[model samples]
Target: MTGSTLVGALVVGLAVGAVGRLVLPGRKAVPVWLTLALGVAAALLGAIVVGLVDRRPGGSPLLPLVVQTGFAAVAVVLAVVAAGRQTSPDPAARRKEEV
Candidate 1:
C-alpha cells in the first residue's frame, strides 16, 4: 500500500481498537499496541470478507465499518483472555510465597 494508505489504515485501526475496547463489558488487560495491531488486522480481514460477500458495485458504506468494528471487538476479547492466561499467577506458587 502507499504511504497515505498506510497512514489512513493506522488512523482507522486506532479508532476501531478504541471502539472495540469500549464494546467489551469490562476493562481489558490488553496493551494499546496489541489492540492497534489487532484492529488493523481485523479491518483488513473485514474488508476482504465484505468484498467476497457483498460484490455489488454500490453497497452501504456502513457495512464494512460495522464488520470491522465487530472483528475488532472479538480481537480485543481474545487478546484480553490470552493476556490474562499468561499473567495469572500460579496458585501453588502463590501459596508457597505466602508461607
Candidate 2:
C-alpha cells in the first residue's frame, strides 16, 4: 500500500473507533489505543476482503480504502457489541425481569 493509502486507512480507522465508542452505551472500559488498534486491524481486513472479492489482485488501494473505511465502521460497532457485552450490563435483561 502506498503511504497515502496507509494514512487514509489510519484516519478512517480512528474515526470508526471514535464513533464506535460513542455508539456504545456505558462507560468506556477499553483504552483508546486498543480501540484504535482494533479499528486499524478491521480496516485492513475489510479492505483486503473487498479486494479479493472484486477479483482485483493486490487491490486498487483507493477503492479498497473506501470499502475498508465503511466496513471498518461496521466492524467497530460489532466489536463494541461483542467486547462490550461483558463489561456493560444488559438492560434488556432487567426489562424482561421487570415484566
Worst 10 residues of 2 by lDDT: 80-89
User: Taking the tens digit of each residue's C-alpha lDDT, what string does model 2 give over 1-89?
Assistant: 55665677788888888888887888666777777788888887776676457775655557776787777877777766676556326
Model 1 scores a C-alpha lDDT of: 0.70
Model 2 error, position 84 (Å): 2.5
Predicted candidate 1, C-alpha RMSD:
4.1
The root-mean-square deviation over C-alpha atoms between each candidate and the true structure, in angstroms, is: 4.1, 5.0
List candidate 1 segments past 4 Å from native: 1-10, 19-29, 87-99
lDDT, candidate 1, 1-99, per-residue tens: 235434544566678787767776666678778888898887667666776898777778777667766776677678877775563278988778668
TM-score of structure candidate 2: 0.63
